[model samples]
Target chain A: MLGFVSGIDRDLLRQFERVSQQMERMMGLRGANGIRSGGVNAFPAVNLGASPEQVDVYVFVAGMDAEKLDISLQQNLLSISGERKAALPEDAQVYRNERFNGAFRRVVTLPEDIDPDQVNASYRDGVLHITVKRKEEAKPRQIQVN
Target chain B: MSENKHIEAQDQENSAMQARGEPESVMLPPVDIYEDANGFTLLADLPGVTRERLNIQVDGNDLTIEGEAAIDMPENMDALYADVASTRYQRRFTLSSELATDDIRAEMKDGVLTLRMPKRAELQPRKIEVSAG
Candidate 1:
């Protein structure tokens, strides 16, 4: 009887391992598409805010040329993509490296009230600021009592 | 040459904070260090930090980098979402006697800080010529 119980336990453990492997692969597929999976260690972290008139997005990235950054908006989806060159020389001996390099893209979905045609972007001090104006109909108005 | 005796990174508080299960008050910026025949180059990514807010100090053999980032929020704007908590960045390092601390060059551009620390003139690698006797 003990031998049969142990065999059942081994089988259950193997099933758990298989499920975990599949879960890892699913997460990897989501990360490869540059979609924010709410991972704490995502590259080029961002902060988002909104006001009555406009929405603001703050992207934090360093050592990048502003002209090379690509920003586009389709409906309510905003995409920011760019490539960061390596900082060190090819022949130099490296001691430590913690910086992110290579190509990176971040996609953010905005609210439906945003006006895609009224967007402005600016880069300053390694931070990119994107502001999108809200539609006139979406603005909050104080209703007067009759 | 086998060991890193010239420069060593030190961050005791950051580790202690993690151990104590407390939130970090200051952020540790990512860095890259590379060595060449002449000297060592240190690059740090300090996003949102401007030149006027950055401070670098070398006291004895201790090197410290401190900076503050200002998040510009327009008046009467509500922050719907925020991932970054702290805007302060700080890191420390210990330098060896072989480095020329007095002659270190620093440059800040696009929220990145580059420090070039050269070796002492006498400690630089030199090639010896073999002459026929």
Candidate 2:
């Protein structure tokens, strides 16, 4: 047998909502086709930091190719450009399409003084990693306090 | 006024139906991309797509997901709000060689499609010890 609760129950409802959303994410991954709307943009999540000597920029760009990517730095802005291509099997019928594929370009700005010439770029798995060494004048320094 | 509005709406709906080809399949849902310490997480919200009809491919730097979203009913069945949409999906990402090609992993749970790409060890930072006098 099951019992019913009154609509006045707030805390219990909140808990139920949280659990339901978590369960939805878990269940969603199993059969997710793609997004619904079209106007959404993909911004690669990044982790960047800088110290006295270097600046690091990391971008999450999976399902992409390194060769197809173009990276450049002008002033404080870093630019990234690439394209996504899709292929279909002969007998397959398309009913729903949610994934984004086509031309993608993203620009990021750096915070510290870096040697653009000394910057290093690499890609592992699907993530793109870039590191730039800061110029001597831009590095933080401490003056002796007497 | 209501009559004119209704007629305009009807004409618009009819044209929409005609353009979309009788709505044989539902449209695909939107997906979100999240990146973290490990790598990238791709989530796709596919509602009625069956595993049998799903097709995933990664060639060179391109990745594509295609499948049909079939709405099958058992005997006497009815449907309501939130219709499912099915269409072909083809996406690609150009990868860099610095990434270890052997470590990409993918999994599907519920109706979400997740693809994980771990960061390579060489790409991660390493500490260097300084010699002291």
Candidate 3:
């Protein structure tokens, strides 16, 4: 009887492991919809806001050179790409490393009403702010009642 | 286990703080620490943080880093979507006695903080010259 109970416990543990593996894969797939291509955690997360005149995008990234950043808009898709170089010397002994260091690209889908030619980007305090003006026809107008 | 030496992260305290019902919960920023023959270097990523908002304090053997990220929202703009929840960042570390706390230098640029903590003169390794008698 004891042997049979132990066998059941082992089976349960294996099933749990399989479920967790599937969950991880699902997370990777979900990332592809918006922020990243195929990764559990997205790099340089962004926030989007819109006003009547324009749309704003804020990207959070630290320790990056402004000249090296690449910001472009093709149709309604905006892509931000750059590389974060390591800070420490090659011979130094690393104790703990939690910061993300490498080349990364994040694509964001903008609204259809935005004018791609009027987009402006600026980097300040390690935050990238992109402002895209709305099309002239897309702007809301206050019509007078007859 | 043997590799875990020098700086010790205060993870238990972080969890405890989260348990309490604080009005503004702090998020720990990711960090990278490395050691050389003379001292240790620490790098922390603090996006959206300005120089005036950053605070660093060292009391006894404890070192703390705290900062507040300012999210700029224009007057006429309304947020359509946001993923970042917290703007406060805090992290603490227990530093070893071998480090020279008084001589520590800090610099912040592009929202990243770099700290250089050198070893005390007496604690650093020294080479002795041998002569024939």
**How well does model 3 score by local distance difference test?**
0.85
Per model, the share of native interface contacts recovered reads 0.90, 0.05, 0.88
Each candidate's clash count: 0, 43, 0
Task: Say which docking band candidate 2 falls in.
Answer: incorrect
Off by over 4 Å in 1: A1-35, B1-24, B129-133
RMSD of each: 10.8, 27.8, 9.8
Candidate 2 lDDT score at position A91:
42
Error of 2 at B31 (Å): 6.6
lDDT by residue for model 1 (A1-146), tens: 99999999999999988887787678666435334434556678878788889999988888889999999999988889999885679899998898898998987777789999999998988889999999999999999999
TM-score per model for chain B alone? 0.75, 0.55, 0.75
The candidate with the higher TM-score, 2 or 3, is: 3
TM-score for each model: 0.77, 0.38, 0.77
lDDT of 1 at B118: 97
Interface RMSD for each of the candidates: 1.2, 18.5, 1.7
Name the runs in model 2 displaced over 4 angstroms: A1-40, A87-91, B1-133
